[model samples]
Target: MSASDHPAAIRLRQLSIRLGLGSAAFEAVQNVSLDIEPGQFVCLLGPSGCGKSTLLGALAGHLTPASGQALLDGERVAGPHPERGLVFQHHTLFPWKTVAQNVAFGLKMKGVDAATRQRQAEEFIDLVGLTGFARHYPGQLSGGMQQRVEIARVLINHPRVLLMDEPFGALDALTRLKMQELLLEIRERIRTTVLFVTHDIDEALLLADRVLIMSPRPGRIIEDLPVDLPRPRFAAAGSARFASLKQHCLALLRYDEPATSLPRLTPLGAPPAHQLQFAI
Candidate 1:
């Protein structure tokens, strides 16, 4: 379907996930529903252990839900598929492998020929701006560089949906800022659909087109706020409007009152470029 015909690249229907069984059972997510439009950058923001990662995994098809359903292109998500690409908080690079090799590894398993894999790997490496480091091993690279390789590895696959779980969480403040810019640049160039998870509201504001806030535990979506801030939002956190939105999210987080009902997604007006508010 066309982008307008199918607004959301991914959609969830009454999704509830319960881990373990009987006495050991715990519901990680309950009655959560969301729609992530194609080419949109969405962020899942919540406190630690609030199941943001679990919700991402369920959307990425890594974890199954106890009830409800997750859909991509209107089809049920059966299991892990190449259609979705994931980059975890911790870089999961093989230290023994060179940067280029690690990036090429996925294509290699897919039976892509050697020359083609190498060419594709090189292209993605360049895309992540890690061209010269191709031959270097992960051990030889700095933490930021290692994460770049992780991003390159996932991007090389050309997946339709990208799931990033705090990809820059391990970096220092300065490095985190740099990575954020790089991500926006790459996303602009590639137009990839992204679902990013982070606890930092400022990071979410900078990178996402929409921010979904989750309640404390038994994680359920509390707010689906549309961020109408213009692109190149690098220093967005410092902007007055951004600060306002950040405070709003924090208030929702700190409020102990239970949400009587889940926030519903609806078509709403765009927030003025310099003034931010949740699009109702």
Candidate 2:
């Protein structure tokens, strides 16, 4: 389907999520609303405890909102379904299953014939660069390889909205960068709508079409910034425009001030001394 004709991949309206019950209930997220268009890559960026994952859980139907609604394709998201696939930071692969078996598990559950499931499984295994390791168990693979298996498992089902909560957070720096590149490559091939959660400003900038920053507890979207940089962004990390946008995001998170209130940064090759210490 054309981008315009594709359905709304995700929509939230005044969504509020509370934890606990009765008087013990405390709001985790409040009055947050956003839309993710089909085939778009959107990132939820915030501090460690700012409800980024809470919002993701609500969308995944693992947690229900105390108020308002989480919708997929204009329909209320009452519970988990195959259309919304979730991948977490940790690999949840079954230890006994080989790489191919892990990827084919979903299809098997849906009663796909053995021959078709095997064919589909191999295709995604290769897609994730695990072709030769199809017979290896999850325990035998590296952390990065195991995560790739988890991704292939999810993508094999062809979910309309892929909810990833720090999917690469556990990988080493080099592996994480490779995984990010792999994700972009896969997206080009399948065009699945993605909602990725990260606290790293650089990662958000590099991957998202738009980045939404959330506030502290009772999390709300404090900043919604579009990433207009060109593709293959791996090389643009040090560009002037890239640094400027990074500084803007840092100022918002560090100073908790409006964008206008922040003074314009110097045009020197390096960011100011104060800007250097705002850790991601």
Candidate 3:
């Protein structure tokens, strides 16, 4: 039941979203308008506090738009739907639950039979390369492995649109690379509209079909750049074209920004709990 059959298209029309309450309230993203083709993998790349996650939250229905409209497949995205799966930087898996149980939670919530839920959960466990670890709890797995379980849980729902907010941002460098490769492999099998938020330019270049550059504070799409590299971009990433694109991205990110710090914004509008470091 993969969304490969018919992925969802996302459209935004003059969307504006504000964060905080009362005197602290301020626009996070402003007048954002864009159309993402069905099955397209688009990365929202920008500095911290640029509203990449805010816009993604709007699409995921975790946050409502202050103005304009957010639509998925021609319908309004007024609230959360199973078809729109959201993954965060950290795994929100229940520590008490086993991998299989966590992955099966969604199905169980939908009133699926236990036998059917177990079977489907097994399939996704194998899909994420965790075949023999079904009984393992979150505490037993590594950070990367826990994230894999989170991803399996999300994918088991067969989402038409996948919203990721720096899903691999917390992993070590080597682990992050492996996770990226794994993500590419998974996306090859399950076609869906992916809107990923990242501050790392290299990650954006390697994973996205197109990259959306956002501005600081009142974020807006300043640029929509396409990654024309071939798939399995390991080799392509070293080519001159990749370097050129990286340079352009650096310029865009570094343009006229002050040395002063800006707090990273989250989907929930709470103060940032962690700092984000940019990679050249």
TM-score of each: 0.89, 0.90, 0.91
lDDT of each: 0.84, 0.86, 0.89
Clashing pairs in 2: none
Candidate 3 has a TM-score of 0.91
The CA-based lDDT of model 2 is what? Answer: 0.86
**Span of 10 residues, lowest total lDDT, candidate 3:** 260-269
Per-residue accuracy of model 1 over 95-164 as CA lDDT, tens digit each: 8999999999999999999999999888888988887999999999888888899998988777788899
Best by TM-score: 3
* Backbone collisions counted per model: 0, 0, 0
Candidate 1 error regions (>4 Å)? 1-8, 260-280
Clashing pairs in 3: none
Which sequence of candidate numbers ranks them by lDDT, best first?
3, 2, 1
Q: After TM-score superposition, what is the CA distance of residue 117 in candidate 1 from its true location, in Å?
A: 0.9
lDDT of 1: 0.84
Model 1, position 43: C-alpha lDDT score: 93
> Which portions of model 2 miss their true places by more than 4 Å?
1-8, 257-280
